[model samples]
Target: MTTKKIIQDFYKSEAFINVSEMEPYLHPEFILEWQSSKGFSKLDKQGVLDLTKELSASYVRSKIRILSLVQEKNQVAVRYSHFVKTVENPREEMLLAHFFVIWEVKDDKLYRGYQMSQIS
Candidate 1:
């Protein structure tokens, strides 16, 4: 599959909501760098998995809206918003974050990414 399609499908995948389903879209060496008002943080493949697991445990429902996604060569830039409600308040869908991320696809999977996000 093309890099663009791979990245887009990854976002729309059930893996986005369920951490256990993430393997197919991730490279073995995947890493993510996050920049937010708090500062910069990084995550390796295992860290990503842990994070998603924690998020899935904490939130009852989740949704994503992809505002724009563009690719050049093996890199993709994505602008998206994520909404979720905590387990404690399942009926209230709140903005989890709005994000801009750049991902590099290698060997047909997401290898690395740099992202900036803001909480709403």
Candidate 2:
């Protein structure tokens, strides 16, 4: 698959709500360097998996809206927003954050990512 397609699939996937299904989208040595409204954080593959598990437990469902995507070779840059239906009010979907991420695809899986987010 193309790098852009890989990223699109990952974001559109239910993996955020089902951690067990996320492994296939990430490389064994994946690393994510994230800068968010709160602060900076870094996570390895396992850490990301654990975090996703926590997110799955906290939210009833999650959705991603990709505003733009660009690809050059093995790298893909995407601008998107996350919306979630929290356990407390599963009937309402709230905008969680807007994100800009650049992902390096290696061996057909996401390897390295540089990400930034703004809380909504």
Best by lDDT: 2
Top candidate (TM-score): 2
Clash number for candidate 1: 0
Q: What is the lDDT of residue 71 in candidate 2?
A: 94
Q: After superposition, how far is residue 48 of candidate 2 from its true place, in Å?
A: 0.4
Against the true structure, what is each candidate's TM-score?
0.92, 0.97
Model 2 agreement with the true structure over 5-41: per-residue lDDT tens digits: 8888899898887877788998999999999999999
Candidate 2, TM-score vs. the true structure?
0.97
Model 1 local distance difference test score = 0.88
Clashes of each: 0, 0
Candidate 2 Cα deviation (angstroms), residue 2: 1.2
lDDT of 1 by residue, 13-94 (tens): 7675587678777899999999987899998988888888888888877778899999899999999998888999999999
* lDDT score at residue 14, model 1, on the 0-100 scale: 64
**Candidate 2: residue 99 lDDT (0-100):** 96
lDDT of the structure predicted as candidate 2: 0.93
